[model samples]
Target: MSYQDIRSTFKLISGGLSETIDDSPKEFVSASITDTRLMGVVSMCVHWRLPENSHLTDLHQFFYFDAEESGFETYRSVLGNGGPSEVQEINDIEDYLMGGLGGKRVILTEREVRYMLQSYVDLNLRSGLSLPEDKDEYEFMLSPRVRLTDSEEYVLMCKQCPGLDSPYQVINYFLMRCVGKDFGAAKFLTKGYVRTNLFPNHKGATLLRNVIEDSPDAVSGSNTDYHVTDDDKDFGTFNTFKSYMCESLIEYSGKFFLLITQITLDHLKIVKYEKISEFQVSAAEASMMTSRPEFITVTDLVPSAPEFDRHTTKLTSKSMVTDYENGQLFMIFQPHNDHVKNATYLLNDDVLGVYYLLEDNQLILASYNLSDIRRMELDLAESSMAPYIVPVSKYEFKDPVLFDFINSSFDDFEDFVATITKPPAE
Candidate 1:
């Protein structure tokens, strides 16, 4: 019988078996037999049991591959064997079963399977899989199981396609087989675009010329066509291992050496002067050096209070005076007030500044450079020192009290440090 006739016979048998079984949970077996020259030519048959369901119970697929046919064939068998009884065409049958059984038809050639397996191995290696750590376990987990008429033939086929030994290979083979070729084609087509646009140019020559003109003494040598070696390339420049990578012509002196930047993560700023060239290739590095100011902590400076309150701590330390001269101390000025006792003041160098902490956890830096320290000192001297002072309070000045000042003046520790130590404008 023809393939369709055989399939129809199986379907009829399945219907009859389903009717016989009714809604019972027990499995109902159905069998069909066909006799024809086409059925006799079946070289290989693979049976795969599919997921059973309420509507379609105990579904199974039987795939048949004939040596004479170009394309393989398959049929759905609901219960049992659905082929002729006296069929003797099983010699060298395993060679023809290219298409996989069941609903998921996986058709893979020997070459494709090999490539898939190799790709799996490559992926595992990339993921840092070690041979010393349960190599057999990994292989077992990754290997694909193939069902065939002959067990020996299946084993031989699997050995031939080493990729089948890895499940990674099998999965990747089907998933990436079509897309991998597309990716390769796209990479080839866009190779020129990537080379031309992706890499930024470094004007090292121009930068060197500027350096030479600015300081004639700094110019030591000139290489117009300098070729950087593979070893010289900075691959780790973007990584955390190194902050910056630089290549320059200037030689290092004991105290100073002119650095010329070529390429950086931020921008492509190159400075070249004839022979002496320096590049500020990294904007991030330059911003960090110039913008970040150095501040000194002054623990000795006294907090401002009423002058008549002689019992308050006195600023007798000469070190405080020295800090003022050096322009490093951050002094606080608290005006004599009854309503707001928590208010404080800050001195940024010679400039008098007022700061307050807001309810939103923000340290606001405002109303600075309004009054100079010299003016405030003079005003304090002229004001009444003996005012109606409040009685002995719980306020005690110490290093711990500095936190209250910081919390009131700045958002956090980092903010306070950044604000207080900010260098004066150039």
Candidate 2:
């Protein structure tokens, strides 16, 4: 094929790469090359920058024409880039393209480079070459199953969970899941924060400064409330083959919270503290939750409280509730008004709304109709009455004590370590 025709084919492949890959590199370049050893055998070279830790920005991949196979084959497939031979081939191609004028090779634009990098990955995948470990980590980061751990009660409700290989995964499965995206739960209810190595250059700790009694010191990376050190012998573990993931329920400042951590002998990879609302009968409930060791579906977490279940059923079923202009009218028949039985209800004088608890212990505030309130005040007790409810807000009361217990703490950090961990025998 002519150089234009070959370039056209590569352009099409790169375009397809652009549409598919989400975390494609922003800086990269591609150039055409020819091998003097193999006549008419052309190759495409892709180069990209690396992270600061890599110590080198110049890294490359070479896709070459295979005369025997009559197709382009991946020449440099592993982590290391192609060496001198590939560089000479590129120089030869540049000389030919420049008509022996000896000019610099053309660098692909930022947009083109992104596609080129993805194209390099796609070709490597098709050729059955080993991908970089970081690429695999990135794939895990983008997975839907991994991201699902960012929901409240996800890890707590989970009967079976895959072993977390990194601190990021640990954070998602515990802290992020408990508090969600906003720092709302941590700000108003909890008294702790999460520390992780997920963002190395950025701040290591996140959320819950207001409730924590002590301010973060300079030694512990002042961005957080407090920090733990590697020298602390209590965290030392002999097992190094597999990572350690520990969870605990704690009571501090007279409030309850869950502590989940992934650590090693030298590094405390991740630590999260999330507040919980209830503690009674949590031991019995926690035992039942962990009884099954298999993965569970969303249906398993459906609210089980009797009154809440009945109310949800009615709301979902169109016949039991009527949708008015501004709100829903819940029908209550005098003879049998058991749908909302045994459920906690509270009235808010400030907003003139009612707050009710669901089977799952989620508190929901609903606005009442002024006309309905007036009718009740006038002593009009009809056979059937409708209480207009406009769903305003809701909050979940995840009981920390119900968590599958790995450990617990109420003592200060120093005392906790000393009590839990004993010094090695002399």
Candidate 3:
């Protein structure tokens, strides 16, 4: 049966039950299987009105049950006051509908009742597994202050959704960190956006803005689509080779290291994130770096061994950005030694691929027998997430001068180099 028909039937049955008990104040607004996350899970909500003399407002009891082959099992029962009451086990649907199986009800304000209902709709109705057809309508009703949790992928699809205005760009950035075959380096890297006022006095600024109106490019993280126009300007002396830059502080073996990553779009529209520079700095220096817009301290990373100790290091994070930028990216790299021969790897999972830096400072992005790009192309054609997957780029490692300087600055230079050079797994 359709959800509407089922809802009506449930409401009728609930009204009948309340009439038999001669309870006029108690109301059953909904008794349908509101939860769509799992096929067999159902949600039931009932409102209990206070006595005529009582000053307190009404209460709502939201009961969640799991439908099994044998019977319905009451798993969770929550009151509108934000308290979870003890679940009174109900084995049958008839018994549950006829009798109010929720053990107790707590007093709740009108705001609290509304919050409880909205929370249930946000979580259950808009689950990843059960996406509603009309997302824009639901998104419009949700408060602008609503929190965007990890599971709200459907809500993320809506243009009017809260959180980031550019949902697709945010998704594509993290898609590289998520979807993909595991070859094991850190899958996700914390990423942020930055803007530079580099060309304040450049000639023809106002005219340029007028000629090419500022349109937000779907694939770009920036509001101004200058990359689209500036890309053509690269033909002459106007070197349009621009990059997106951001910095992060990583803790390693009790020391903080400053990491700067540069992202650039290749000719094919694929986005590549290259680790441009790194420095071992004091905590004070790390804090001072945040004064600049590009640098931000990442507080949550678990400290690991220093870079060179890892056999496979993540050199870049990448994503397949489309002409109409929507969705996320997959990863690119795996260890040179572990690459399976004749195997077509899923492009989506490797957006945050690993690499190995040689003694000469040349970075080995990926190594395998299959020399053709068609191996990845073939996988992309057959995969469901093909649109989000992008081609990988061979990014050159940063200058070795900084690498040499940092190593020399180390107190135990020889010992540190020896430990770093050793092939430790990431």
Candidate 4:
């Protein structure tokens, strides 16, 4: 395997890391979007210049060798003459590569990339000295199941999902699933966001700004119309994680957008509050005293909601709806249809399309046409804070006297927390 060939392999599969492919007929790799992030850059840097990192060099060699030894390939860049001809250091190669020795591409962090390469190395080590050192041979000999893709929901639920235990797994798991469902959902309606961490360097700038918010608390008001409208750095910078995944989702979402909750979680949580943002959320319907726990999926969460009898899209007469992938056409159909009685459809990011149920029968084919729908929202995940997720209905919040009683009667804030968090019936 040459460097360019290996890099090409990485690049070809970079966008859809969690996808199942026949690297070999019998071998299966459980690649998830969340875990396969390493591969994205691996593909990019095969022919691109990478920043230098002393610690990551060995790990890089391991990856380079893995690709090469396993039928992959690489080529030393032919440096153009008249460029600065100073070399001869342990770090000289990276500099040579960066100095137009190779073209630039998406920059993968040395640390994160090594985390992925090292994971494979460690996994190989644990399997012992007898582990196949031959890359092609190893792929040729894996259990067939190893090559199949795991369900997006199951992968995320793994939290410590062993099958996808690398930066590759992390990247692939989240991105593939998002591409199939989350990103597509954002395409039609509802607000979405991409959140990430802050760097140490930004602290000083943040502190300087804090001195000016003038209020003892530099950032104030958890939710209101003002914060969403207010253009403030208080939300933070767009990092690489957001840059990579959100951009993909953005392009796929058909360009329908309103106020974005890209800045901060706190800012987003309050988007629905009247005092919160100019962008209005669809108001709640006439909710009655059927039960409160039904809001949660895990029956154990509220005891009153049904158990996990089967994944079904049973909606109360008042709820708005969308398909598992949130496709606009599917989303639009729910307002006028009773989903529970229609054909069932499930999202299969592991595959190319939605797994649909045919009309008057249980034939599970992957499509939207000529199907009798029977269920919905089986594996959908939404945060109480998500703009689309309606937590409290208007009917429940309309009576100011009752609302105040619930809020104020809880004594201090801690009591309030416990009260709302108790059994749904409570």
Candidate 5:
């Protein structure tokens, strides 16, 4: 039968069959189960007759009836004949409706029915399926079990039921309608696309908002306007180069060295001012030097001295000398005619300490010690002559490994010279 017809039939039978024993409140209290599977069980109670002048009795009896089952006969047997009650399978809705009805039957008005249903809803929210000790556990029990299969249905229900504002009520309704055994609403709620509008403005909704906002898909965007271009890549590369240049200065003691082929007059002035103040060549002199033959012999530039060693026996005119003293001066000599080549030799043959060469406005400064060349490079760079400072070697070593070993082990130029020039260990 239809739900309204069943409710109306239950109301008529309950009112007509109720036994009125005393004038002590003829009010009939009734609760109904709306579950279709349970066939709607009704619990009705009414006050029983008491002896005159006898104290009000505490004992009260309530009749359990279901019209969808065996009808009035079964109810009468249970209530009137006092026979063995039939075992009836009860669900959550039936258990909730039948509880705390006392033992009196009464007809409930529409307002009373609504109030009782609201109370049942409230009680279910407060205590969940059972009275759990933890409030969070109770909330979990009331929360909807939304499975992947039923998620669409639950979402539709949420959209349709605009009046269901309470999160607990919405969850409970969805859970009651769901057929799946496994549920994962919490995991689903963490996804970015899930709609949270149906949820009440509570802590769970707030947390869901945070989760959505923090999601990778939510935080990232696909805007074509923000995409990187070749210009941006170039700019990034430029910035990286600038950073490397700046850091290299720190690595090399606040100085940058470069091997450059060309040098301007202005660059020459910076080199002269910062490094070599004794550079007496004028612009006219530099121009004159570049115009001469590219190949010039060492004898033409500087006079050679007699080779000698202070530690060993004095060298005679015919003796051949392979090595020299530590402080001995030498001339800057280039083996080949090419000025572009940076490899220059410091003649082991004794010679004056100072010599200068100029080609195409490029100046080469040479001295007996390596420290002077390093100092000149530093001063030139400090004066913004970084592009003009050449990385040419001042002298070629007989043993390149020994030279490198000394350079690596010693920071002081004097120590390097002393260590390299010391007598061989016995």
Candidate 6:
């Protein structure tokens, strides 16, 4: 069944299932078993805190639920990081113990992802078994916001769609359908990104649109049937897009990062900003969530250095951008005092990862990846989390030099370079 159908069934059977983990109870919830990450792990979170000390320290021995066998089992990965363990099968499969993005799963928010790395020193994390220290570097590899996947492609075989014969027109329709609900027709066309912006010079679609227009007479004869239906026009919009895709426009269309959709850019342009100015001090509220190294080496930020230890929502604008480097960019804008964070970000280059700098907070296109972001199990009772993420760029960084300078200024830049630029030590 589809996600919607299955979701309806879950609501009907469970009678408003609520999830309560730790001391907190999430009221009225339902569960489903579709796609999820960390197949062997499922969490029940009633609170955000972890216990003082979790008995389980060895990342290799974590338990996972085996959906196929209807029992708990182990999953073997050839490229293993070893955070999973095998527990004995349970005869009683309770309601909360079902599969997928349900249960007390910890949603990796921006603050949560930052807390994970700097707070915990024990747990090692993995993203597809590939862990990068900083968020921006990791975010550089995620799926882009505007992408067309192939398991089942949307095809407009019928024609009545406007720009049916134009590939770009079809894409515009798709984007229009996929964008935010409130975008009206005039706002999009008046001051929006046009297809011509992406393929500057009308290079790709120019010839195709021309061919269709000129072929009406040649297909049959002079004035054979110079007519098209409303349905045909709509479908034509869809067909032009599908035909170009099938003819390999997507595969060979080199510049995928040229983001051009009516509603997307509108959403990106923000009027207010909360930005962190300097590095946060060790004693500030920022330091309260993130843990400092116990040894207190020179490599660490001097707890008294007001310059490197201050925390604000502001970040340098020109930060280096990668596909999903760590989706960990911590940017500061002039308007807001707090940075909007995201553990997941969409990239211009067709990738997705944990992005720290939030889209809503700043007009800039970067997220920060601290040197400490890691993966660890949160033990409820103690307000501590060890989440890891990669920061990604929402759009291209027009300036390269400034981008590098901002990221390298952070302490974690050394670690970020090592993980993403080289293979892990064997």
TM-score of every prediction relative to native: 0.16, 0.17, 0.21, 0.17, 0.14, 0.19
Clashes of each: 19, 0, 11, 51, 8, 104
lDDT of 2 by residue, 1-426 (tens): 111112223211111112213333424444433311111223445555444323223444444432221233333421223466646554433322222111123333333323334543554567665544334312322222211224423322121123324432333323332322223222222223543332233221211101111112212223333344463436563222123333433222233333433322212232233222323224344333323211100111124423322124322121123222222322221221111111111111111222223223332222233442333323212211113222232222232121111123321222333453568889
RMSD list, candidates in order: 32.1, 27.2, 24.9, 23.8, 44.1, 21.8
So what's the TM-score on candidate 3?
Answer: 0.21
Worst 10 residues of 3 by lDDT: 204-213
Report the C-alpha lDDT of model 1 over 1-426, residue by residue, as the tens digit: 111111222211111223422233433132111111111112122222223443443422233322112112232223333333212121112211211110112343333333333333554455554322223212322335433345544443333222223222222221111111222211212111211111123211111111111122321223222233354357532221111222222111111123432211111111111222433334334222222122222211122333322112121110111111112221232221111111110111211222222223222222122233234333333445213222221112222222234335443444555555589999
- Candidate 4 C-alpha error for residue 338, in Å: 50
Give lDDT tens digits, candidate 5, residues 355-400. 2222122223332335544543343345433343444434433332
Candidate 1, after superposition: displacement of residue 303 in Å?
Answer: 30
User: Candidate 2, after superposition: displacement of residue 331 in Å?
Assistant: 90
Model number with the top TM-score: 3
Q: Tens digit of lDDT per residue, candidate 3, span 1-426? A: 111112223221111111112222443233332322111223445545434313322333434432211112222222222222312222122233322221122233333333433554555544433323323322322454444444442332221111222322222322222111110111121222222222222211100000011123223443223333453566552343334443434332345554444444333122334444555678667444322111100011112312322212112212111110111112233222111111221211211221223332222222221332233334334544333333333322221221232234333223434565689889
Per-residue CA lDDT of candidate 6, range 328-372, in tens? 342221121011111111111111111232222211222222221
The per-residue C-alpha lDDT of model 5 at residue 207 equals: 7
> Distance from true position, residue 220, model 1, in Å?
37
Candidate 4: stretches off by over 4 Å:
1-218, 223-249, 253-255, 262-426
Tell me the deviation in Å of residue 284 in model 1: 5.0
Candidate 4 structure quality by residue, lDDT tens digits, 49-146: 22232221111111221211221222122111113341222123333222211112333333333333444444446544223233432232222222
**Native-to-model Cα distance after best TM-score fit, residue 3 in candidate 6, in Å:** 33
Residue 46, model 2: lDDT of: 57
Question: Model 1: runs farther than 4 Å from truth?
Answer: 1-120, 123-138, 144-426
lDDT of each: 0.25, 0.29, 0.29, 0.22, 0.24, 0.22
Location of the lowest summed lDDT over 10 successive residues in candidate 6: 206-215
